[model samples]
Target: MQPTLTGRRIIQPPRSLLVRVRESVDFLARHSPARFAILVFTALILVWTLLLSLPISSHARSGTPLADALFTAVSVICVTGLSTVDMATHWSGFGNALIFIGVNIGGVGVLTLASILGLVVSRRLSLRARLMAASDSNASRIQAGPVNEGQAVRLGEVGNLLATVAFSALAIELIAAVVLLPRMLAHGYDLGHAVWYSFYYAAMAFTNTGFTPNAAGLTPFVHDYLFLGALMFAVIAGAIGFPVIFALVRLWRQPRRWSVHVKLTLFTFAVLLVAGTIMYIWLEFDNPRTFGDQNAFDTVFQSFFMSVMTRSGGFSTIDISDLHSSSLLVTDMLMFIGGGSASTAGGIKVTTLAVLFLAAFAEARGRTSMEAFGRRIPRDILRLAVSVVLWGATTVAVSSILLLHITKQSLDIVLFDVISAFATCGLSTGLTQDLPDSGVYVLAATMFMGRVGTVTLAAALAASTSRQLFRRPEERPIVG
Candidate 1:
């Protein structure tokens, strides 16, 4: 039998003061997982915000403007595409590189990296043992699933999670760069400019932030395949949650078998994308500003891209502001939905909405099982899905009320803006530039909240683990 820690090892606390305090807090919690995720994100963002706000280099021509730096840094770290500053003109290469590092770190998440490292070090096997190790250890990226449908949802074994995140990001980014290279070369950019453009586009696309190193972005190459190709791939990849991507990859290797998560995510994503695309095409057919000049094929392409971009990936072929009301409204809905859970894209998340729909359908049919992807949606998952939706919507509504008070904007415009910030969607109705610092900070905070999620943030603040479901003790209820 394997020996378990029974003495000083079991009783000992973390050596570092910070860790010790954290451990004491964690010990008090019934569920530490959610709290831990939130804490990791909050702490990282805090450190990143500080680093960007400070001027590190002595030879800099001007000290980084605090607002611009903070805003840019937050955008990168949250992987939110919104930007207050012109990245190309304002920051030096050093600053841009720092921002890129923040983007890479934030896009994938710190906890994910730590989880990868933990998985490597522990030398663990057996699904249950691995999950316990992964979940209990802050380093474990995210405990994923209960493979068996009837069983309690266990934290998913890390499996290909790490490899899929790392390699898939790189491979896609590299391919995008390659696709963009020819057009960049043809666009009168010198060898240096071409290479730099490739690198820059790759970074911007992968991060799903619309910050462009080139002043023109893909606008200069609106008709060019190379430029469009990179943007197209990047946004699509970003829009498709990481979990689905990895799951799809695993399914490809084992063609006959696909996990429940993989099947559902892919199914839900396809339906949303196709539906969003059709809506855009239909809504914008009579409207000229969005896709009026383009031919049918090009129009379809542009609409598709815009639809995809709405859900957290911020790149757009045409200036998003030009879109007609109907198109913008559809895009807003897409943004509100966001991407899948355990994925890079933000908003309320696709999975939450998916599970919700499943639950609702089950209720309507008077069926006890919430069927999705031929698998019964577990009660725990359904509860989490509901919590995510409820918390996200409430937060967005409150944030919107405050933002409208400050901006004095129309309800439609303010709602769009608030949703954009909270979803980290970055599809603005052009209010970002005119906002006061307080307003900007409010939006920025919303973006941060959107990125890490409200539940996780609340858990971190309270130092309590969160469960998807719990029993309620009976009490006298107040009447409405």
Candidate 2:
């Protein structure tokens, strides 16, 4: 009955509607990496919300409210440590493990994980695939160009970007765990607990996320400089960005060959970190509520940690609420500056600030061009830097005003919360937990935008410049 004889070949049936839809989605994902990345994060947050809302996810018999669950999921997935509930006390082991997994997912990024998975599944990487991955990770940009050596070189860099991101993240987390495990064990934690804490803290530190698994928080380890030091190293390593880490590993001996971006990031990060440390120590030297009670070594070390953590590490060795107004203001500025671009850290970004200052410096010196690292800084980059700063500042200002209206909190406290959320820096003025649901949602949305919005805007702007074939007549306009 089937065909006693096939003089002609049987034609295959077309794919089902669902399969066709999936194929269409796959095609879209392959082309629009940034869009795909956003979708992935959104999906992750939704799934996390479902899991977190389950009764088993909580230590208490009842499940968490949907709003709180959604907020926690977003915060964890964004690697922003602002939480509606105490991570250690409010959630059970299942919740803790979920948070840990989230940190890693958000730490390395979804696009990166997807790309790595794709690499394994496909068993080959093409130039197109590399571009998509790079876009997803915000690793770098590719320009349209003729088929040439320069384009070839950039394509090669894209290939390496994916590997560098995955490798550096894992390697740093591993090293941090190894260094901190023994310290945790010595602190009287059981071997199982110690190992879990080590891995958890390592993930948090390297991701620059501020979530603490310990109910007492870092207060118990306030005097444990070894543990603190390891965390600092991990935070700095992650904050420095993957490209910088890769460069340091591959070109450690050749500082002269470093890219301008790397040089600017390093120089700016160093300047800000040192300046911040000095300022904190100076401001809080006599503030009895904070560093004034500490001994010389503790004060100095705590100030240093504060400086490093302010730039998106989100950890505090001291009670942030007790810091002097001046110290808090300084911290606000530092948090807004954030860490390096393409880093686990978030803020306006070091390179953006560096480029802005460089441009201003050049203009002040009456130079027609900006230069750094022995090369001319491109005009487009300067534009991008300015855009990022303006957007970030505007977002912070608007959010602060809205939060003030909602909570009727002091300007200082409200502004601090806003900056922290916008920078993805989890440091707070003890207000997050007390805020009304509306206020919590505001901060949650702020954190989400801070984690994804600014950078995505920058990428969109960067990729959208058109080389005009014609120009309007030049004209001068009045300016400030």
Q: Pick the candidate with the highest TM-score.
A: 2
Off by over 4 Å in 1: 1-33, 54-60, 117-156, 253-256, 461-480
C-alpha TM-score for every candidate? 0.83, 0.92
Candidate 2 Cα errors over 4 Å, as ranges: 1-14, 137-153, 458-469
Candidate 2 lDDT score at position 22? 88
Give lDDT: candidate 2, residue 60: 100
Question: How many clashes (backbone N, Cα, C below 3 Å) per candidate?
Answer: 6, 0
* Residue 245 CA displacement from its true place in model 1, Å: 2.7
Provide the overall lDDT of each model, using Cα atoms, as 2-decimal numbers. 0.70, 0.82
User: Model 2, 139-159: lDDT tens per residue?
Assistant: 334333232221112556755
Question: In model 2, what are the clashing residue pairs, if there are any?
Answer: none
Which residue pairs of candidate 1 clash?
Answer: 31-465, 32-465, 115-139, 144-156, 145-156, 339-350
Q: For candidate 2, what is the total of clashing residue pairs?
A: 0
